[model samples]
Target: MLLTAVAPAVWGTTYYVTTEYLPPDRPLLAGVLRALPAGLLLVALTRRRPHGVWWWRSLLLGTLNIGAFFALLFIAAYRLPGGVAATVGAVQPLLVAGLSAGLLGDRLTARTVLTGLTGVLGVGLLVVQPGARLDGLGIAAAAGSAVVMATGVVLSKRWPAPAPLLAVTGWQLVAGGTVLLPVALLVEGPPPSSLSAGNVLGYAYLTLIGAAVAYTLWFRGIRELPPTNVTFLTLLSPTVATIVGWLALGQDLGPLQVVGGVLILGSLVFAQLRRRPSPAPVRAAGGPAAVQDLNA
Candidate 1:
């Protein structure tokens, strides 16, 4: 889960990067640049293709995790204030926890439920601005993005990847990029006729760091960690973004942001508290092998 945190933390830079260097009115194009090229690079490098059910599974997961989610997220980001957009996404933990409990049969302890709520509250405090107005479309897109991403993560955990992490990530990336390709062309038109050096650099950073490296680690973590626990790590994105702002953009944190940080950290610890491992079954000398199996 610690390694998985790197992905969201890397993603924390997206808003800043998009605003700073990427071309305006090109959200779908940005998604293409961020997902397609990097995915193709990964596929080319691995040359390990998915066989069997993975072909369709990759498409579904990619649509949820990358194609639809990125499109909706970009819409929300452009339509709403940054803080409001981020706050909207902060709903993911609760969604993940609920989906894990209902669909995956993963236990939802009270601590986890409360901590998930705390994460939402904490993120709201840290990011929501005073006068953030809610756009209907932005809200819908933001909420839909959360639901799609949470569902994707839970499904990814439920269905273990048959291939190695790189191959799995690459497959999904390609599937997702392919899904987004038509949308990008339809909405944003053909790729920009001209590319500035800054645009090239921004695209490269997003392709290499944001998509390839971050997603590889992300899928690996999802393959190993419990779905709900893994989703909790995403709460760190806004925190990382805030820290980046403070360090790079000279933005300062307020009192609420400080308190919000504490609550977010505290809830992260709070959720995992009292998670004792279940002990192995002990076999009695008189017990039959079948009886031992039941206990196991």
Candidate 2:
């Protein structure tokens, strides 16, 4: 769980890095750099590759988790403030809870529903500002990104990969990057001709820590933790982002933000109280609480 939690915690840095360090007007390029290089590097390192049904599955998961999610995430980030954007994305747990009940047949326990609602409420306190102007396209992208990823989380649990974990992870990264290559070029044009040292360093951090390292842990946890439990961990991302912004960028931490952060943390801890780790061997099927892997 600690390992999987690292994925979103690392993701929390996205808002700051995108705004402060990355080259301007190139979110698609950033997404490509974040996914493809790490993926190809993993592909190069791993001797194993996808087989039979995995090609399409990897593509679909990759598109949902990284390609479309990343593209839309950037759009929302570009359109909305990070606080507003992260608050919007915080709905993933609720979406995941519903999807899990439908797809994974996990019971919608009272604990799950209550905590999910409280968690979103906490996030609203932490991030959403009053009278925040909304953009039509941005709202659609943010909500779409959440839905795509929420669906991907459920589907990944439903279909456990046949390939080795890292290999399966690499395949999705490669597939996601491949799909985004043309879209980035056509929609946003090529990678910027000039990149600052901070930009390069930020990209490197995202590619390695955020994508490769973080995603491996995410899938590993999915193979171990319950679906809603894993989704709940996403709440940490915004909290972490908010804290980081407060410290690094000197963003103000209003009283409400503090209360909200505590509430979110409490909700996350409460959700995990019932998570008993599974000792069974990995298998193709996801029984209720079946260990599955990978997420946005």
Give per-residue CA lDDT, model 1, range 64-90, as digits (tens).
Answer: 999999889878987898788788888
TM-score of every candidate relative to the true structure: 0.90, 0.90
| lDDT tens digits by residue: candidate 2, 1-296 | 88889998998888788888888788898899999999998888887778888888999999998899988988898898666777788889889989999998888877788898888889989998888878888888899999999988888899998777888789889999988889999988867778889999999988998899988888877878887889899999999888898999898889998899999999999988986878996465565444444221
Q: What are the lDDT figures for the candidates, one per model?
A: 0.86, 0.87
lDDT of 1 at 34: 85
Q: What TM value does model 2 have?
A: 0.90
Mark the 10 consecutive residues where model 2 has the least summed lDDT.
287-296
- Model 1, stretches more than 4 Å misplaced? 272-274, 277-296
Candidate 2 stretches with Cα past 4 Å from truth are 275-296
